[model samples]
Target: MNANVLRYSAFTTDPAGGNPAGVVLDARGMPEADMQRIAAEVGYSETAFLLPREDGTFEVRYFSPLAEVPFCGHATIAATVAHAEANGAGEKVLHTRAGRVRVQVDEQFTATLTSVEPRMAPLDPDDLDRLLAVLRWHRDELDPALAPAVAYAGAWHPIIAVSTRDRLARLDYDFDALSGLMAQRGWTTLNLIWRADADTFHARNPFPPGGVVEDPATGAAAAALGAYLAHNEALPADRVFRVHQGDDLGRPSRIGVTVPEDPREGIRVSGTAVRITDAANQAG
Candidate 1:
């Protein structure tokens, strides 16, 4: 197994500010067990393993510390950036477990991933109550405009919009309880958010199911948020927004989101990634 993993932080240019993801540019002979073990050893929220195909497209898989997830946005960004850095910037088609993902890397090395067709589902009231209980949040604390729902781009994320930024900042929750509930419901993360304005938002994601307490920047969740906003008819004129995350964790990240006019089209998530050097990793 000649798996060479490169570390990169997505959603930020600074290595220490965004979410770190392990990228294996080539994993031709690597087994699934080895991928899972490598992910665990990397100790990041997620790691991306790419197997290059004969036709230029790549087959990709994402593994967290605990299990394999269908897709991961941050890892995708990190992996593609790492690929662009080595092979020069351009487009790549990724065959993920969820669906086909089209990623484009600009000359400046900013990677934008267009997710597979997004969908939204109603959040069962009983399930919402259980989730709130585990999160230690009251019903009144939620934002009235953005109703809670399960949104899926590649993975399922429950979109919970809080009324205040302070509420979003205070993110203490029952780890075991939330993890059990997420596993039962097949949710990747809880997309807890606060709308700063029409075009600005603040987000915090709890990823207990991935064996991580929180995700500094979550591209999948950002895509889900775009879907949620479009579904609720709450999107701005241009249907574009910026999401600021990881402030509470001290590793700030910025994610750009674009929702298409047609509901059938997938959401577009754009971000930059920086390679994590040995010194930077040690400092972090």
Candidate 2:
């Protein structure tokens, strides 16, 4: 095993409750192929590689077991927390393929990533129709008040708002179909959401493009959703909310997002991460 390779679960205090990510803090000399191979060997949904810069910044890259992705939220959170634990908590700038992301970690090991400027686009009616069929959802299942759209906050995701928690719980989907559509549209994940209240939401993400059925905690998607809701005036003036995800997968996770008054600015996604012990991996 690579000594530099560390395992951490993001978005939860318990190592077994959040999204597992392999974090390589000193991957400066590693080749792209080696990083990919290591990510595959780690067998997590995603792994983060950090190449330190002379200016104290980092050139970060994310990879799944099957392919490389532009940005990954869970991996970023995990990596920052791991770094803070080893080197002391502070701020770090990550230069990702998508954009530059600013992250800060406090002494408590809570990490927050501020996404790039968020943008929203309309989800084509034709695509929405097809997506619903693949996901076994009907038009009536959608929340009429919460409009669906494609939002980008470091990464692109289709923000879908369902009407009921029951509708969101049944997550069976046509993996191949959804993955193909997302690939063609260049989306990272399908942010399937159900608004729980004025300040709470339930979400599930389909990440077949990364060879994973679902992402337990997706901070990028949460950030995007915050922007989406804020721009549409759908959220409260406070623009703070908590998202519950991964319950159906038995690895429950929570993500907190704060949307600023300026919609074009970055959104803040905060969560806790814990180092995963080998014993926990063996138990799973």
Candidate 3:
């Protein structure tokens, strides 16, 4: 209960933008219940707890207000930046429930996390139907170029690509229904996206299972999205793209993704994080 938690916003230099996350630099003996309580108190989309090991690696856990997640991208970035500010900018390996995640922090406070080996699976027809129904979206609105699928890179996300940006902007969904469906399917968030161009995309994530209505910036989903684009062969020539998220919510976050040619390799998600001071926190 007396843990020293630092607040940070990831994917944006401004405190008002991006996704806010709580970072517990040292939670060596904290119980799972305490972590959950702290996460709820923080009231962010997610919080990260780090327990250091003898080998210098850290065993990390991510928690939302409702439950624990296998992995969380924004929290990882925020924690890494906080760690870098305290220690020094360098690389660190995080042992998460999903898998080992390698993270690097630069002098500029930019952090890049390499996701676990990503994979994609076909979405069940019945599940897709239910999902679309809950979101009040029809099949005709979907983008045929990017087939719907469940993509995983440290966490599982259902990728739903819409044809137009306007369709993606109007995000009105049945919260309770979507929550039940996500919980039953063990999905972390629904990655709703629309391709702006060959290298630019817009995303909105619905995280009902986490007790969050929507996530302004979702790093894990961005990694999963990279895998989805690669699997569908929809990547541009460079296999790099920018994800613009949180604009609808007025947060305005930017996430950079780099997809490797090797399907078995991890995707690289890069972004900057800024510490949320007491005044900034109060303002937010």
* lDDT of predicted model 2: 0.90
Q: What TM-score against the true fold does each predicted structure earn?
A: 0.97, 0.96, 0.97
> Which tens-of-lDDT digit does each residue in 154-264 have in candidate 2?
889998899999999988999999999989999999999998889999999999999899998898899989989987889875889999999989899999998888867
Report lDDT (Cα) of residue 172, candidate 3. Answer: 99
**Model 2 residue 274 lDDT?**
95
lDDT over C-alpha atoms for residue 197 of model 3: 96
What candidate 2 gets wrong by more than 4 Å, as runs, is 1-3, 279-284
Model 1 Cα displacement at 38 (Å)? 0.5
Candidate 3 residue-wise lDDT at 128: 97
Order of the predicted models by lDDT, top scorer first: 3, 1, 2
- lDDT of each structure? 0.93, 0.90, 0.94
Report residue 59 deviation for candidate 1 (angstroms). Answer: 0.2
- Candidate 1's C-alpha lDDT? 0.93
Question: Tens digit of lDDT per residue, candidate 1, span 237-272?
Answer: 999999999989989999999998985678999999
Q: Residue 42, candidate 2: how far off, in angstroms?
A: 1.0
Q: Pick the candidate with the highest lDDT.
A: 3
